[model samples]
Target: MFITIEGIEGCGKSTLMEKLANSLRSAGRTVIMAREPGGTSLGDRLRAIFLDSTLRIEPWAEAMLVNTSRAQLLKEVIRPALERREDIVCDRFTDSTIAYQGYGRGLALGPLEQLCDLATAGLRPDLTLFLDISVAFSRARVVGRANRQDRMDSQSDAYHERVREGYRSIAQGNPQRVKTLDGSLGASELLQAALVEISVATQ
Candidate 1:
């Protein structure tokens, strides 16, 4: 199972990813949990640079760097595990580029999708859970965090709103593969909602 979780920052993807992994492990499934702009040593370096709030990056540059990290991750971690028949749960993937760079930064979608296809070699999630939240709650959750905001996190409300809208559009376009969850709901509810789709996907 190649499952990817995506959403705007502060949308509780990390929390729910943890729960999903644990549940799968409890059921004796070998789950490989991975995150991106990360998941390998090279990816970590890119992640640090990509997430640095103090730095400014051009839209194309941002797309290139993150996809570079993702490419490294696919080679180093994601593919091998899948070949071994291990279930993989990934945090963010190609759709993020479309949402963030293409939608949020107003980059050209056609090229961005091409970059994504090149980076992932056409491998896509078997199931995608998009935790949906409004920009206002997204802002509140992000602001309340104790850690300093990342470059993407520090983007303006309008940018985040556009990203959220992009996610909605992506979900609508790919309904068979992606399911949108209401992030304002409690964690357990979100987990149950996700598991419903997981059950169908796995069956």
Candidate 2:
């Protein structure tokens, strides 16, 4: 299964994906954990550039850069892992581009969707977990972060709100493949909920 987790920055995507990967491993599944704008040598470099808070990237440029990384990650990591019958859990996928660049950045969704399809070669996640949180919660969590904030994390509250809404819209549009989870839940609860959803989906 190619499982992707999506949400606004600081919505606990990393924590949830880690727990899911560990759970899958405990069940004797070969799991590959990946993050978008990453998961390969070239992707990591692009990730650094994308998150360099000092740099200014236009919306379309940001979209293309991420797709470039995605193309590399698919060729080097995700597609091969799937070929080996391993379960892959990714922190973000093509949907992030649609939400961030299309909705949040105010780009055309049609072009963004086409770009994603081209970049990924029609690949889509078998399951997508959308962690839903309010803009207020996101702002509080991002502001409380102890580490250096990435460019996405440093976006304005309104931008984060649009991204969050974008995620919700995506979930609504893909009811069978996308599951919405409350980001305010406890860690254990969230993990269990995700497990249940995975169980149902894969059954």
Best by lDDT: 1
Which residue segments of model 2 deviate by more than 4 Å? none
Cα lDDT of model 1 by residue, 24-131, tens digit: 899899999999898899999999999998899999999999999999999999999999999999999998999999999999999999999999999999999999
Each model's lDDT: 0.93, 0.92
Residues forming the 10-long window of minimal summed lDDT in candidate 1: 147-156
Clashes of 2: 0
Model 2 C-alpha lDDT per residue in residues 1-203, reported as the tens digit of each score: 99999998878999999998999999999999999988899999999999999999999999999999999999999999999999999999998999999889999999899999999999999999999988888878888989988888888888988888898889999999999999888888999999999999989
- Each candidate structure's TM-score, on Cα atoms with residue i matched to residue i, is 0.98, 0.98
